[model samples]
Structures are given as structure tokens and as C-alpha cells.
Target chain A: MSVVYGRVALIGLGLIASSMAWGMRRAGLAEEIVGTARSAQTRETAREIGLCDRVVDTAAEAVKDADLVVLAVPVGVMGAVAEEIGPHLKQGATVSDVGSVKRAVIAAVGPHIPDGVNFIPAHPLAGTEHSGPRSGFAELFDNRFCLLVPAENSDRQAVDRLRAYWEGLGANVEEMDADHHDLVLAVTSHAPHLIAYTMVGVADDLRRVTDSEVIKYSAAGFRDFTRIAASDPTMWRDVFLTNKDATLEILGRFTEELFALQRAIRTGDGDMLFDYFTRTRAIRRSIIDAGQDTDAPDFGRSKVHP
Target chain B: MSVVYGRVALIGLGLIASSMAWGMRRAGLAEEIVGTARSAQTRETAREIGLCDRVVDTAAEAVKDADLVVLAVPVGVMGAVAEEIGPHLKQGATVSDVGSVKRAVIAAVGPHIPDGVNFIPAHPLAGTEHSGPRSGFAELFDNRFCLLVPAENSDRQAVDRLRAYWEGLGANVEEMDADHHDLVLAVTSHAPHLIAYTMVGVADDLRRVTDSEVIKYSAAGFRDFTRIAASDPTMWRDVFLTNKDATLEILGRFTEELFALQRAIRTGDGDMLFDYFTRTRAIRRSIIDAGQDTDAPDFGRSKVHP
Candidate 1:
């Protein structure tokens, strides 16, 4: 748990980057943390909040001589950021990313990595609706699963070091092939988001017909969809764009099943509705049993910190 | 706030009935809260937990001399229960119900109400995924909205009295025609439930293909669907069957929008995806601003006390 990386450079100062910085400091995993943001205002704000040991003018300068360089940019910008840091990354330095889509990030950042640096593409399946440097906390990675999608012939020593780094920050790590990772995440995150966005859009358009009725009675269940749909537009846009194939695959299955349910509703098949509802209830129970989610519907109604 | 109804009776005690009983007692809105269930075991459990003042054997007995008879039964059973309690309901009594579908409940129960009795259908826009008497809490109605779908030519006094009773329980009250209420709720509750149920069914079937990856990597947002799908099967079965028209209407609209998004994803139309995502995000923010939902993306982080 001692400082493993003397200099840990975070390329983006968003929620993931700031949270990792907090975790690094809290766990004493990094002696110095350097960060860079595209906008001067965010860099200034990140510095004001003490999100890192040093704030840099460019990705290359931030990552220069750093023992571990983390790419936390949008998926669309991963290639450019990787190219910027490729020449300056220290020898044998471990390079990693925290993007939602794994395949696209690997494709974009893979070529830019210096041969000596370990390019480990990891996605920590943890986040809040909030974003930006000021929004992170130390325990954000606690008990969360982080999937590392490394090349088949990735250096074991580099992989082990990166594993140790995430473990030190309190994340449980597993490794998978990049395509399988995308497919798994397509079912878990990407399709759910698109469906949520679709439903929210429908509800919004229906508001034109129903006026404020959607907002008024939303406490029933539509409210939750709204929250999921309210995710960062730019981030989700990139996720859909980068994770297109897998997302489309799952969405196809989803729409097919939705059509079946729609037919059941149209045909007055109550039993079909009941059976589907009953089966889904067990899945929620399984998630709770797996220790991934809480059994209580609303986080046990826990109080929020002021 | 004086007692608005003396000798109040509730038939078919489940989430809504039990919650109504608890809230009525807490607010002193009912002089005596009597209840009836189909089985003696439930009656005993209801009495043991103080869910009702007097647990009765028959719906008819429970309704005798009651100034307000709240039919909190399954949509499918509304007719039978109304017929049984029709003769015993006291003259000048106000009869209201807390069923999801207003038009169906009215059609089932309308003929049974005597000339002097007023049948004011209501859909209380409140509940948790949990069911049964033990799940009930007095504060479940606090800050929630209640829709009173009063029958045409309904008694004004009875409507006002019921409104006062609900207000005493800390709910905002609105009046809508039974048909309109069913349509509005079909969008907010029924359609959402069907979609959740269908998605959960899809995931459950994918268990073999995805193995435990579905639960382990559920952080991607599939967990929310599980929670929504875990709601009571009987209640939702009844919702779909009773509100078929509105649910189907909304389902058609949802499918169309989902298809548009799916096509965008299939064609790599980032502009369309971004626009849909951005539009949905605004609706979510509006719902939060309207106070219908918390800003929390994961309600599991919430500490909502029952």
C-alpha cells in the first residue's frame, strides 16, 4: 500500500480522474499526482480544489516522466491524448484508461503507446450522474469492479503492477478480451441507457399531448428513467458511437422482446405479463445475492450528506 | 382536521389498502378503520400488526355502517367485491377506490353503488415495489399526489370530504375524469412496468449466454430494470389488463421512438443519437426540477424511510 507510483499523471480532470486522485492520496498509492484539463477554467478549478499534486499545460507535459499515466478523456479524444503522451511517457510506465467503451479506446490508444509502457485498458464500473473535477470522492472505487481489457500478449509484470495500483485504490479487478468486454457491457450498460433515453424522449413528447401529467405522476416509475436519461450527453454520445455494434446487437434483442410484450398487452395476455414480471423479480434478487446491488429498492433510504 | 369519515372500511388489503389504513389512522381521518381480506391468515396478520382497527370476515360485514368504503382490491376483483359490499354500504356513504385503472374499476363497481352512495374512483399515485401489510407505513402518502376520478354528476360534498381526507394524509389532490386518469397513468406507470418486465425477462433468458456476467457487471444500469420489474406481479398483471388501451398507445409510441434510436445506432448516426440523448437529458432535469424525483441516478443511494 506504500507509494507504488512516484508520479501518477491523470490526463483528464473529470469525475473519474478526480476520484482516482483522491483515492491515490487517501491510500498513499502515489507520491505525486499531475493532471491536465483541456479548458483553462477546469484546470484552474481542479487546482483550486487540490485535485492533484501539479496541474500541467498539456497532456505530454502532465505525463512526462510520470511512473503511471491514466487516460480519463472522452472516448472520442483518447487517440489524440494518447498520441500527445506517447512520446513523453516514461520507460516501463503503465498507461491505462477509464472509458466506458473498451474496444474503441484500445483501437485508438493501442498504436500510440511506447513499446516499454504497459497499455492496460481498464474500465472501473463505477460512476455517479455528476461529473467534473469537483464531483469526485476517495471511496468512489470501493467495492466496485474494474475490468482490464489487455492485449493477449500483454506483459505480465506490467499487468500485475496495474492490478496492484487499482487494488490499492480499493477496486476488485478482472481481465477480459476487449470484444467480449464490449458485448458484456452492451447488455449491462449501453442498451439500458439507450432504452432509458428512448423512454424519456417518448415521455417528453407525450407531455405535449398530456401536458404536465408526465411530471405530475412520474413518482410512480418514470422518474427513475428520467434520472438515467439525464446522464452526461457528450459522454453517452461517445459511448453509443464507440460501442455501436454491441449496443445495436443488444438493442435489437431488446426491441424484439419489447415487441413481444407489446403484442401481449395488445392481445390482453395478462399471464404473459405476470410471468415476465415474476422472472425479472428473481434477477433483482440475484443481483442482491451477488453483492452487486442492494435488496432495498431505494438504497435503504439512506440519508444524504450535507 | 376533523375526522372526515366515520367507520371507514377497506376491502382487499394489500400495499394500497394497508397503506391507506395506516395513513388514515395516523392522520385521524377515519373514526374506525375496518378491513377485510380473502383469507383469515391475512386478517390475523393484518390485526397482529395493527394494520386495521377491526379485521372482519366478510367484505359485507366490513362495509356495514361505514361512511367511507375504500375498495382497494385487484382490478379483476372490483366487480365481485363491489357486489358483495353494495347492499351493506351505509346510505350517503362515499365510495372510493385506489385501483390503477379508473375506468375499469368504475365499470366494475359503478352499478353496485346505491343511489345515495357516491362512487368516486381514485388512483393514489404512491407505492413501493414491496407488497403485503407489513410493508405498509403511515407516511407513505406524505408529499405524494392523489388523483380523484370522480364519476360524472358525482356529489360535490363527497368529493370535497375525500379531498380533505387525502390532504390530511399529506398528499396533493387533483381531479380528473376516469378515462383521462387511466390514460395519464398508463404512460407514467403501466408502460414503464411493462418495459421493465420485458427487459428483465430478456436478461433472465440471457443468463445462460451471459452467465453471471449479467449480475456481476450489472453496474452498467440493467440493475434499475430489475428493481422496477420486481414489483408485485398480480398488481401489474391487473394494470396491463385494465389499462390496455392507454398502455398500448404509449407502447406504440415507445416502440417508434426506440426504433428511431436503434436505427441511429445501427447506422452510426452520432448526430441523431446525440440529439435523442440530449433531448432525454433535458426531460430528466425537468422532472428533478419539478420535485417529482430526486436527482439521484441510483435510488439505491437513497435513504427513503418507509
Candidate 2:
């Protein structure tokens, strides 16, 4: 395909940005790609790996003369980076972000957009436990859902162009309201991550189990929680903090349901446990049917088994 | 790789027993693997799949003259199957089980064992989300832990033979006491499974999020919980019913720790959240380093990327 934008700027050189660089290059989504990071070490790594067409020293420098600019930094720093790059954003350029929490990101970065710049917030529901510049590949976003949150009264052509660009990068783009996106993400990602983190922490704090035993026997179930818990701490921290109310709401529901199941176990309610488990199995079937996850047993990790 | 047992009787033809059939055949651990299931359909499937050397119609017929008899049924039914097979067990035979909960299985099955017969309960800490006769594989036990819980006065020779057989099946065998084994399994498998089930149930119960949204966006984190929660309903129900005290205890601790983290989130304690998450990250590294799980990104599901 042809270039979706004359030039694209990435304000962070982490997993998402590096992946975007490779994916965009693979599909020829942009004529030129400029990237920057707050950490000099990250910038050096990106440059050494040739993550983008040009590695700049600042977000402002990266945004200059760019037709499309994506803020791929942590949620906590979105506003600061937006403020720094707002004036440098070229007129008529479309500015988008890849933050997980949409409402908070829109609230944080929307004000800093210049008059002629269109700000769109997009989040791709895809990732691995690994992070940073070297941990990304071009297929990271392939067939993954990328939710686009465009402001009311925004430029229609720009939104369409950004959606096309995401399609070019191999993601299925769908428009969603920022608030609904946060709520959906809270249920699907944020609360589950917190629960995994909590379970892993509980295992770690148990003195009788011993860390070695936990590590050795983790294949039974606990290792999946550990993988989710091992995701980048800072990014997750910002996710929970920014998506606070929705996450807490879902978690509250989780605790209530957990208590009910605990009561069933205590009361020896075999039928209740069986019915609940049976219902949850259907959802897994639907996930596989939707092409969102693999139906291969154990998430296809059997290949890794010794 | 010589025959460890002249004839091994598997009392059930489910995932564990079927996998044991393949694993034993792969290593020639048993001269003959005779199997039976309470369900005729399961027995037919076993016959169709060649899951055993001989597929008998009853536990009694399967255990006749067998050197090693393994009760590979659900934990809640151990007593009945043990009672049925006890009188038929050979005088010098070894009768063991692959139940997840040791204390309960030992308590239920011990009194039924006849004189001169050895009763050793074992639990293989390995499985997948799939079940039934067709889901079995030769490598299901490969490098996974198999905990052996021998009675205080059990025969040393029988126990050693059983351990060797499991090793030949590609598992690392460890000897543990019954009560301790239950508690350890509660922490590693039972509690995590309950949490996953609870979390998945909550997501399904959420009316506002919609089922399709949860299934589509699930790759973020919820898919892992769903995969775990999709485990065989009957087996998990029996597991919770049999291992009640320890599972409830670990879950109690899990809820306590989760509440603390929730409080931190509510109070905007970023340091506490970050520190807890960072600490959990080390556990994943240890699990991977110990070779219990793969460190490849997304558990190496990247290969399935579209």
C-alpha cells in the first residue's frame, strides 16, 4: 500500500511505538517515521535498532513537520508530553494516542491540542508481558481490536484517515466513546490484571508454600497469574490510577462474586459450583470463536512443555 | 524403560488416565495398561482411541490380577471406586490414585484397601483446559511435578516403583505428606482456579459491558482467566468439595491481600501498588528460570498471530 501520512511522529519508543514503526514500515503506512523518548537510554536503543526513520531528541522536535503524531507514552505523562509538543505540531496534523485508559487520556491530553490539529485517542487491545523497544514485532497488532475515540465535532476526514492507517498496520479499528471504552477496558483488562497481581502477591507472601515450590508447581494454575502480574509495573500503575472508578467498580463486583463462590465451597454446594463453571466455559468458547484467542489447549503452551 | 508393572489398571478414562496410558506406552512403563470408566461412552472412546491395552467394562474387571491399580477418577468419588476394586486387587498389588486433593482421597480410600495391598495416593500437577479421552497426550506429564503421598506404613518397594514409573512418564516425582500436599495444592492450583472462575463469572454477569465486548477485548487479560476457568466442571467441583478447608484458607488470605491492594488503589497509594507489582514480577522470572513456564512473549502465542 501507499503512505497513509506524509510523515508520522512517535513520542515514545516503547513496545507499542516500536511495533508501530515496524508495522507501518511493513505496510508502508507512512512516508517517514520520527520517534523520541523521555529517556535517553531508550532513544539510544531505538536508534541502534533502527526503530524509526529518524530518532529525534524531543517530542517537540519529532512533531515538527509531521502529518501524524502519536503519543505512546505512559498515561501519567500524556498531558506533559502533549503540552510540550502542542505548539510544534504541524497545522492540520492528526494527533492520536495509544494509551489504555481513554477517558483519562482524553481528559489529560485533549486541551493541549492546537486549533488546526485533530486529537484522536486509540487503544489496541493487544500486548505481552514483555515491554520496551526490543520486545516488539510487526505482528503485535495483527487482527487485534483497536478502539478509536474521536471527539464530537472532530474532523471527519482525519478520523477516517487514522482508521485507515490503523487498518494498514493490521488492526481492526472500531470507534467507541471514551467513557465506554474505559468501562469496557476496566472489565476486560484492568480488573483482571489487578486480580492476577493480587493472587501472585498473596502466593509470594505465603511463608509455608516457599517461593521455589510456587515456582516449581506454578504450571498447575498460578503461572498464568504471574505472567499477567509481570507486565510493566509503571504502565499498569498508571492504568489503575487513571481508570480508578471503573476498575474499582468491576473489582467490587469481583469480590462479591468471589465471596459467593467461597460460600458455595464452604457449604459444599457442588451444583452451584458446577453451574457457574459450566457457564464460564461458554464464554471461553465464544472468545475462541470470535478469533480473539486460540482454542488450542493451554493457550497452545503445550508446545513449550518439556 | 522396562515394564515397572506387569499390568496397570486405570479406573477412569478421562484426561489424566488417558494421558497416563499414552505416557506409559511412550516410555514402556507398563507391560499392559487395562482401563475402565463408569460411563460407557468414555469406555467406547477409549477403545476407539486405543487409550489402553484392554478397555474393560468395570473397575473390578480392570483391576483383576493387575500389579498397579490407579484410581484416576474425580476426588469426590474415590471412596466408591476404591471400595469396588479393593476385593479384586492382587494380594501384592499397589493401589494409587491421581486425585488433586491428597488428604481427602487418603481418608476416603484408605479404609477400603485390603490387607497385603499397598495404598499410595499421587497427584500429577499437570493438565490443560481440555478434557475427556480425546484430549490426552503423551507429553502432558513431561517435566511437570507428580506428588506422591504414601501412608506412614506403606511398602517402600511399591512407593519407589511408582516414583520410577512417574519419572519414566516424564514427570519429576516428589514425595509429600497428605495434609501438606493438600495445602500446597490449594495455594498453587485450587485458589487460583477459583479466582479465575470468579473473575470470569463476574465479566459474564456484567450487563453493561456486553458479552461480545468482553470476548473481543479479552486478549488484554480476561482470556487467561477464561481459559483457566474453562477446566472440566465436574473435576473442579469435586476438587473444591474435597479440598474445602485449605482452599478456603488460601482464598481467605487471597481476599485479605486483595483488599489491602484495593485500599491502596482507593487511597491513591502509587508506591504501594508499584512496589507490590514489581515484587510479583520477580516471581514470574523465577518460574520461567526454573523452566516451569516459557518466557517467550505472550506465552509464545505470537506464532498464532494473524
Candidate 3:
């Protein structure tokens, strides 16, 4: 593969940015890659690991003369980083972001872009519970959906180039409006994460069941919730803060369904519970059929006999 | 790995019973294994899969002259099955069960046992979303917990022999009271399952996000919930109906915690959300350390990059 960009600058040295750098290097998507992080420890770790071709002290220095500038910081800091790097962005460079929420990122970073530069917002809907620069690998985005949300007046060539770059990283890229992206993500990711956190927290607070017992017997179902709830606190906090309306809307629907199920349990309505569970079972089949997850038992968890 | 029982009878040939049959055969824990299922299809499947040495038509026939009897049916029918087999149970036989709720199984199956028989209740804290005879494997119980709830004055030799059999099958065994087991399971399994079902149901009912989109974008977190919610409907319905008090109690606590998190989200309280999430993260680490789950990224999911 040939280089799509002369130099690419990653503004945050975290899981997504580190993975992008590794994947791009593996596929030769960029001629040179530079990265910067606010934390001195993170920058030092990235330098030691050879995460990029160069590690710079500041975002402004990293973006200077770069053909592609990726704002990979937390959602809350995307605007601030954009403002800091606005004056240093190269003329005609393509500026994009990898924030989970699209509308807020566009609103925060759109105005700071210079007239000649093109701004395209993209979100790769893929991750594990692990975070940090050390937790990334070249295959993180492989077979995952990377939704690109281009502003209405955005340059067509810029959007297509970004799509090609993501494709080179092994992601299937699709175009979506900002509002639809947030709504769809809220249904799929944001609300489910919050609900998992709540369930884990509730289990933690139960005094009757010791923490050790919960941990020991976690294979039943609670372990899955813990894995989701264990995601990076800062990233998820920003997601909830930025995608407030959609998360709350889906959560409201979740509470209503929960109440109905609770009523069925209280009333001993076996039929209602059975029908609801059966319907949900069909959705799992669809997800597996669509290649989102495996059909193996217990996600093919390891069997370690102690 | 010597045979511990002359003949063992499994009343229902589902995931648990079939797995027990396979595991017992692998370790030579029982000389002869006999099984029966209510549905003709299940019986045929059991016979085809060789799940048991003998696939009998009636629970009474399965239990007749057997040294050990295991009632592995749904919680709601444990009593009926117990009554059917009680008269046929051999004197000095040990009767056990594999229900999720211990107190209810004890109450339902305890009275019918003949005076000379030893009645004990057990719950295996392990299973997959898949069910039926075909889904069983010898390694299903590896490194899992099997909690035994024995009535006062239970025969010590019978309890010890059962523990040895489970150990031979690669499960760690523990003893607990019936009521305590119910509450602990409610915290670990029942409430988590109900919450997953409710969340999936909410996503399914949403008109804004089509089912295909939900299925496609499920890898984030919703996919795990769907896996849990895909569990057998009849078994889960019976669990909720039988263990109403404990499940309701845990769900009430879950709702209270969820409301607090929801309020924090509405008010943009990032600190509160971050703190709660960070606290839950520690529990996941403990689960990994306890060997209940693997720490591999994305649960070691298969990478199918298209």
C-alpha cells in the first residue's frame, strides 16, 4: 500500500490513537506519524514503545506541517485541543476527529479549522474494556464499523480520502449524519455501558453478599457486566456528558421495560417473562448472523479447572 | 476416578443434566447413567447423542433401583417430578437437584423423598446461553462452582460421595444454606439476567434504531447483554417466579443505584460518574484474579475483519 498522507499527527496517545498509529504503520497508510499527549508519563511511554515515528511535547508542534491532524483526545477536550492547534495546521490539510459523540465534536472543533483545511468527523465503533497506549494493537479496528460524519459543506475528496485511510486500517467505513450517529450509538453503546456500571455498583453495595463471593461466582453473568463497567472512567464520563439527551432517552425506555418485567415477576406472570426472553433470544441470533459476535458457548471462554 | 455409584438417574436431559452425564462418563464417576426428558424430541436427541447409557421414558423408570437421583428440570416442575419418582427411589439412595434457586427446590422436592433416602439440593453456578442435550460437553463444569445445600441430619457419607463425584468432574464444591444461596444467586445471576433482558427489550422496541442497525453496532456493549438475555426462557421464567423475593430485593437496589447514576448524568456530574465507574473497575480485577473469568481483551473474541 502507498502512503495516503505525507505526515499524520495524533493529538492524544491513548488506545484509539495508538491503535491507529500501529495499524497505519502496518499497512503503510502514512509516510510519517507523530503523536503528543498531555501527560508527560504517557508521552514517555509512547516514545519508549515506538508508538509513532516521532513524539512531540505539544499538540501544536505535532500538527505543524502535517497532512492529517487527528484530534484523539477525550470529548471534553477536543475543542480546546483544536483551538490550540488551529494556528499551526498546515494549509489544505485534512482535520478529523475520533470522538465517540459526533455533534458535540463538530460543534467544538468545526469553527477553529482554517478556510483551506477540510474537517471530517469519524468514530470507530470498536473497543475493549482495556484503555491506555499500552493496550492498543494493530488489529483493534479490523472488521469494525467506522462511521464518518462529514459536515454538509465539507470537501468530497477529503471525506473519500479519510474513508480510504480507515479502509486501509481494515475498518468498514460508512457515512452518517451526526444526530443519527448519536442516537444509534446511544442505543448500542452509551446506555448499555451505564446500565452495566449501575448493576456492578449495586452488587458492590450489597452487604449481605461479600465482595469475594461476588468475584468468585462471577461466571454466572455478573462478570460480563463487570467487564463493561471496567472501561476507562474518563472516556465514559465524557461520553455521557457529551451525548446527554440520547443516553437519557434510551435509559428512560430501559427503565420502563425493567418496571414491566419487575411487575411480571411480582405477579408470577410466567407467560410474559417467557415471551419477552424468547423475543430477546432472536436478537442474539441476528447479531451472531451479522458477524458482530461469535456463536460459541460463553463467548468461548477458557476452561481452567482448579 | 473409580465409579462412586452403581447407577445414577438424571430426571431431565438439558444442559446441566447432559453435561453431568458426559462429565461423569469422562471420569467414570458412575457405573451406569440413566436419563429421561419430558419432550420426545429431547429424549431422541439424548439417545442420539448418547448422553446417557439408558434413555428411559418416565422419571420413575429412570429412578428405579438407582443409587443416585438428580432432578435437573426447571424449578416450577421440580415438585411434580419429585412426586413422580419418590415411590420408585431405591432405599438408601441420595436425591439431589441442579436448580438455580435452592430454597424453593428444597421446599418443593424435600417432602416427597422416602424416609430412608437422603435429600440434598445443589445449584451449579455455571451454564451457557445454549440449551438442550446437544449443547452439553464434558468440560462444561471445569473450574466452576457447585453449591450444595443439605438438610439438617443429612447423611454425611452421601454428601461426601456427591462432593467427590463433582470434584472428579472438575468443579470446586462448597456448602451453603438454602436461603443464603438464594440471596447470593439473586445478587450474582438472577438480577443481572433480568436487567440484561430489559435492556435488550428496550433496544428492540425502539423505532428509531432498526433491528439491523442494533445488531450491526452491538459489539460495543449491547451484545453482551443480548448473550445473557438469550438464555433459555422456560428456565429463567421459573427462576424469577420461584425466587421472587430475593430477585425483587436485588432489583430494587439496582433501580435505586441506577437512579442515582441517571441523575448524575442529567446534571453533568462527571466526577460522580467517574468515581462510581472507577470503583466498579476494581471488582473486575478481582474476578480475573479469582480465575472466574479471563482478562484477555474483548473476552478473547474472534476477529472477523471484513
Candidate 4:
């Protein structure tokens, strides 16, 4: 395959950036991949693991002479990193970010982009609960959706090339407006994650059920919540802060639905509960039919890994 | 292994009962296993699958000569089934159930037991979302917890024998009082399941996000909730209905914690969110260490299953 980018700069050393680097290398999408992390330890680890062709000490150095610069840092610091790398970005380069919250990222980093550069934002809707540089694998994005949110004034050619880059890395790319992306994500990801964290926190605070008991008996349903709750805290905190309104809106809906269900339980309205559950059960079938998840029993969660 | 019971009867041949039948056969723990279900179709399916040595037409016939009778029905129907089989139960026989809510089962089935029969109730903390006769598997109980809630003044010998029977089925057995068992499960399983159902219901209700969008993008976090929400609606309705107080108590705590986290998100308290997430993340590690779940990436969920 021909290289899609002569030089690709990844400005974070976490799971998403490392997986992007590996995915690009797997398909020969980038001629050279340079990455930089804010922490010296992360930079050292990236270099030691050969996560990129060159690991730089600063984001500025990483973006220099690069045709594509991916600002994959935390959403909270994306603007500062963009400010630091803005002047060093090559003219006519394409700058993209892998932030979960698109509106905030656009607001934070959009102003610093040079006139000649095309700024596009994308989010790959795929990940395991595990994070960090070592946790990445090349197959992370295979058959997954990578949403591209192009600014209204963005160049069509640049957007096409960015979509091509993601496709080359084995992601199915679709274009969505930033506002819709945030709301969709709020429904699909943000609210669910916060709910999981809240459930786990509640379990942790229960005095009657010890921590060991909760952990030991978790395989039924609580374990899945724990898996979601275990995601990188810094990343999630930034997500809730940046995508506040959409997440809150979805959560509001969730609380109302929950209260209704609770009321049914209190009132012993078994029919209502049954109908709701039956309806939601069909959605699971739809998801499996869409090839988004496995249909294997127990979600095919193996008891042991060899 | 030697036969633990000369004759065993399984009423309500659903997932748990059929699995128990297969598990007993796997360990050679029962000399003869007889089963019956209210649904004639279920009985026919059990016969076609060789689910028992004899598929009886009535619960009375199934329990006529059985030394151990397992009432593996929904919590709501246990009392009626117990009454139907009560007169036919052999003298000095041991009777147990595989209901999710122990207190409710005890309340329902306790009165119908004959003077000489030992009425011990047990709840196996394991299952797949799939249900019915064909969903049964011998390995379903392997390494999972089967909690025994012994009745007051219950025979110690009968309790020990039932525990041995479960152990022979490849489960780790522990005994708890009925109230404590209900409270513990409400914390571990019941509340989490209700929350999952509510989240999935909320997503399904959102007109802004089409069902296709929810199913396609569910891989991020909502898919897990859907898997849990796909469980048998009849069983869950019974569970939430019978274990009302404990479930409501845990959900009360959950709501309080959720509101605190929601307030933090609204107030842009990144530190609070981060700290809460970090604390819950440690619990995932604890779950992994406890061997309740695998540490395999993505819960070792297969991408494709043939």
C-alpha cells in the first residue's frame, strides 16, 4: 500500500495514539511516525517500545516537517499542545485530533491553526477497558467506526485524505457534524460510562457487602460495570467536563427512565417491566445482527485466557 | 464419583434446572434424574435432548421417589410448585431451589414442606443471558458460587449433603442466612441489572438517536448493558418484584452516589470525577485478582463466533 502521509506526528503516547501508530504501520499508511508525550516517562517508554519511528521530547519537534499531526492528548490540554505546536506545523499540513468531545476540541484548538493548515477532528468508536502504551494492539480499529467531524470551512480534499488514512488503518469512516457527534456519543458512550462508574462507586461504598464479596460475586452483571469504570480516569474526567451539556441531558433521560422502572418495581407492575426488558432484548439482537458485537453466550467472555 | 442421591427430581426444567441435571450427570452424582415442566413443549424438548433419565408428565410423578427435588422455577411460582409436589415428596427427602431471591423463595416454599422433608434453598450466582432447556450446559456452574441459604432448624446433614451435591456439580458452595443473601445479591446482581436495563431503555427511548445508530455505535459501552439487559425478562421481573426492599435500598444508595457524581460533572469538578473513577478502577483490579473475571482484553469477548 502507498503511504497516505509522508510523515505522521502523534502527540500523545496513550492507548489510542499507540494503537493508531501500530495500525498505520500494519497497513503502511505512514512513511514515518513520530510521537511525543508530555511526561518524560511516557516518552521514554514509547521510545523503548518502538511505538513510533522517532519519539520526540516536545510536541513542537514532533509536528515539524510532518504532513499529518494528530493531537491525541487529553481534551483538557489539547489547546495548550495546539498552541505549542501551531507555529511549528508545516504549511499546507493537515492537523487532526482524536478527542472524544469534538465541540470542545474545536473550540480549544481551532483558533491556533495556521490559515494554510486544514484542521479536522475525528473519534474512533473502539477501545478496550485497558489503556496505556503497552496496552495497544494493531487490530484495535478493525471493523470499528471512526467518525470524522469536518469543520464547515474545511477542505473537501483534506477531509477525503483523512478518511482515506483512517480507512487504510482498517477503520470504517463516516462523517458527522460536531453537535450530533457529541449528542450521539453522550447517548452511546458518555452517559453509560458515568453510570457504570456510579454503580461501581455505590458498590464500593456499601458496608454490608465487603469489597471482596462484591468482587467475588461480580461475574453476574457487576463485572461489566467494573470494566467500564476502570477506564482511564483522566480521560473520562475530561470527557464529562468538556461534553457536559450532552452528557447531562442524556443522563437526565436515564434518571427519569430509571425512576419509572423503580416505581414499577415498587408497585409490582410486572407487565411493564417485562415489556421494557423484552423490547431492550430485541435491541441486543439488532446489535449482534449489525455485526457490532458477538452473539456468543455470555458475550463470549471466557473464564480464562490462555 | 459416587452417586450422591439415589433419585433426583428437577421441577421447572429451565436453564438452571437443566444445567443442574447435566452437571449431576457429568459427575455421576445422581443415579436417576427425573424432570418435569409446566409447559408440555419444554418437557418434549427435555425428552428430545435426553435432559433426564425420565421426563415425567407431572411434578408429583417427578418427585414420587426422589431423594433430592430441586425446584428450579421463577421466584414467583415457587410456592405453587412446592404445594403441588409437597404431598408426593418422599419421607426424609431433601428439597432445594435455584431461585434468585432467597427470602421470597423461602417465604413461598417453606410452608408446603412435609414435616420430615428438609427445605433448604440455594441460589447459584451464575448464568448466561440465554434461557430455556436448550441453553443448559454442564460447564455453566464450574468455578461459580452456589450460595445455600439454610432454613432455621434445618438438618445439618441435609445441608452438608446438598453442599456436596453442588460441589460435585463443579461449584463452590457457601451458606448464608436468607436476609443476608438477599441483601448481598441486591448489591451485586439485582441493582446492577436494573441499572443496565434502565440505560438500555433510555437509549431505546431516545427519538433523536435512531435505533440503528444506537446498535451500530454500541461497541463503546452500551453494548455491555444490552448484553445484561437481554436476560430473561420473566426471571428479572420476578427478581425485582420479590427482592424489592434490598434492591430499592441499593438503588437508593446508587442514586445518591450518581447524583453526587452528576453534580460534580455539572460543577466542572474534574478532581472529584477523576478521584471517583480512580477509586472504582482499583475495584476492577480487585475483581480480576479474585478470579471472578478474566483480565483478558475486552473481557475476552470474541469478535466472531462460529
**Highest DockQ among the candidates is held by which one?**
1
Instruction: Name the better of 1 and 3 by lDDT.
Output: 3
lDDT of 4 by residue, A1-306 (tens): 679999999999898999899889889999999999989999889889899999989999999999999988889999999999999999989999888899999999999999999999999988777777877778778888999999888999999999999998778999999999999999999999999999999999999888888988887788889999999999999999999999999999999999999999999999999999999999988998998877664342332113
Q: Fnat of each prediction?
A: 0.77, 0.80, 0.81, 0.77
lDDT of 3 by residue, B126-169 (tens): 78888998877788788899998987889999999989888888
**lDDT comparing candidate 1 with the true structure:** 0.83
- Report the poorest 10 consecutive residues by lDDT, candidate 3 chain A: A297-306
Interface CA root-mean-square deviation for model 2: 3.2
lDDT of 3 by residue, A201-266 (tens): 998999999998898888788888999999999999999999999999999999989999999999
The C-alpha local distance difference test score for the whole of candidate 4 amounts to 0.90
Give the 10-residue window scoring lowest on summed lDDT in candidate 1 chain B. Answer: B297-306
Error of 3 at A39 (Å): 1.0
Off by over 4 Å in 3: A297-306, B297-306
DockQ of 2: 0.63
Write the number of the candidate with greater DockQ, choosing between 1 and 2.
Answer: 1
Show pairs that collide, candidate 1. A299-B300, A301-B303, A301-B304, A302-B302, A302-B303
Using lDDT as the measure, name the better of candidate 2 and candidate 3.
Answer: 3
In candidate 1, what are the lDDT values of residues A1-306, reduced to their tens digit? 698889999998998999899899889999899999998989999989888989988998998889988999889899999987899888889899999999899889999997888898999988776778887888778878999988988999889888888999888999998898888888888888888888878877875346378877888888777777877788898998899988887777888898888888788888887887888888888888988877555542222222
Q: What is the TM-score of chain B alone in each candidate?
A: 0.96, 0.97, 0.97, 0.97
Against the reference, the lDDT scores of all candidates come to 0.83, 0.89, 0.90, 0.90
TM-score of predicted chain B, candidate 1: 0.96
| CAPRI grade of model 2 | medium
